[model samples]
Target: MKIKRRAMLESTGLNMTPMIDVVFQLIVFLMLATDFTNTEIERVYLPKADAAQADDHPDKTRLMANIIHRISTESDCPQLKYKNGVLLQPCQIENHWKIVVRGEEIKTQERLEELLTIEGNLDREVPGNPKTPSNKPVMIRADGSAPFHLITRVLEAAGKALVWKLEIGAEKPPE
Candidate 1:
């Protein structure tokens, strides 16, 4: 007896619509998350610390003030490091530096203090108590070659604002 040949199976393609949607969703989520976190930080070359501790648990409500030196002219001896694609150089001139907070450049010390004061006024630990300082933490991220006086000015501003919780940013020395 002659056996009948089996019918050939039809090839099916993958339903990629759902997969593509999922991938796009993930991309959007990651972009949003990255923007929120990075908006608060400014890239600056930090000083090397012998005993620097990693910020494993960063507070979400923490405030950051970044001291950036606007590199004007090429230096004879550059810092030889790059942070956020900007070349780090030794800038001793006070005018070449500026303070940035929450993506806004603080042009004057008065303006810096004013902004910090507003920040300090919110979320008081002891409600309705004027003496109670703000619970929010503030951090100063200064470039390695930044002038000490500028950092001091930031400290004075924080003190004036009554935000006591403060931190200085530093990086571990290269091994």
Candidate 2:
């Protein structure tokens, strides 16, 4: 008895329709997820330094303050944006700097202090007493062109808020 083999194994091609649909779905999901997180953060051109290091608390709940210089925008510099509930529209002004936190611009140091204080107190069970020694960590991502006074103001506000665990975000200089 002669046994006949199946012809060409009936070449079954991969079903790409499901894969393409899954890929499109993933892209849509990522776009929405990234937009939510990024909208809260202002784009900052962090100062570069030799001592710049990687963040130790990558996943910690830390408040951020974005400081950018307000002047003419060059190829190297970016335009000043107003964080009015949403970081929208370019703003016109003379030589000055602006600070943004949680998509809201900190118009005054008092407001900065107030905002930080409120955020810092959120984790505390008691109004003034913190269960932990340190409140939430605060990071200041100041632009390279931003004035030193702006940075000082941010630091002062952080101090007023009693944020001891603070960090200045910087980029590593090119080797």
Candidate 3:
């Protein structure tokens, strides 16, 4: 007796569920990762420089210190009222100036120094070594109209924290 053999062909399709899930996960991860840089940065008019270098590559562990200059809304100056159909300049008090770090406003220099010290100590030459200098980099982003004294104070704080690596934010002049 002879047995007959038959060939069976079935169509197979690729399951796209895993691929879609992976794509969604990657999108979420990128959104969360990029948010850190955006939140730390503040809206400040940077000084224009002829020799400003573009930051093609940025450090991930760099700390950002933003100095914002704010004009006082409640000023005692009578010039705030329109005179001769022209509005005068509002009072820009030094007390209105504030330093922001990591989306938190730093009211006092001592607190700012303490924050910087803690961040600096996160990455030291010797692990958990307080005596060694910090390997962390810091960037100062100050408004063009901001007072120089404020920048000086930030410098002092950074120096005290032993964070030697520093970068000043500047914008290139429009051609």
Candidate 4:
């Protein structure tokens, strides 16, 4: 008698449930890991420029200054001053628009004239072509809370100092 044999079939279906779950988990993880925060100055409104470019190159040898306007503890009026990166006591707070360089506080007309003369003398000492401007530019990282008047004053001072360029904005780290 002939023996009857049966053909065996194999299952070819693949389960995608685990893979889909993992992909969703990865998406959620990435979305939660990224954070966007702005470090704008407090209480001061910054003027917005519609035509401003997002990616501008920062000057390499730039001089930085911070302008702070606060109410004086002794007086009720607002006071302006130039502070270094850190708010140290050496800061000059007498006038909001004046800045000191090389141990001299430049504020009045006479002082400014003296300052310019001193700067000219120093520039003469450097061994280089007098016609060429300084390689270093002036970078003004004024607080958004700072007044426009103060910022303009800083720009004017930098110009008088023969700074190659003037840049004003908040500080950002390089990518």
- Candidate-wise lDDT, in order: 0.79, 0.69, 0.78, 0.47
List, residue by residue over 113-141, the lDDT tens digit for candidate 3: 99889989998888798668888989999
TM-score per candidate: 0.68, 0.61, 0.67, 0.38
Clash pairs detected, candidate 2: none
Give RMSD (Å) of candidate 1 vs. truth. Answer: 5.9
In model 4, residue pairs whose N, Cα or C atoms come closer than 3 Å (at least 3 residues apart or on different chains), thus clashing, are none
lDDT of 1 by residue, 26-48 (tens): 99998877755657777777887
What is the model-wide C-alpha lDDT for candidate 2? 0.69
lDDT of 2 by residue, 1-175 (tens): 6555665566689989999999999999988777454454577667677887788645445688888654445543355444432334433343556788887877877999888877777665455674333457788888665667777887787677676767788888668
- CA RMSD of all predictions: 5.9, 8.8, 10.8, 13.2
Clashing pairs in 3: none
- Give the runs in model 4 whose Cα sits over 4 Å from its true position: 1-62, 74-131, 171-175
> How good is model 3 by TM-score?
0.67
Q: Residues 2-109, candidate 4, lDDT per residue (tens digit)?
A: 554442344457988999999999999988985432221222222344554453665332334445444435763333322433322232343543333333444554
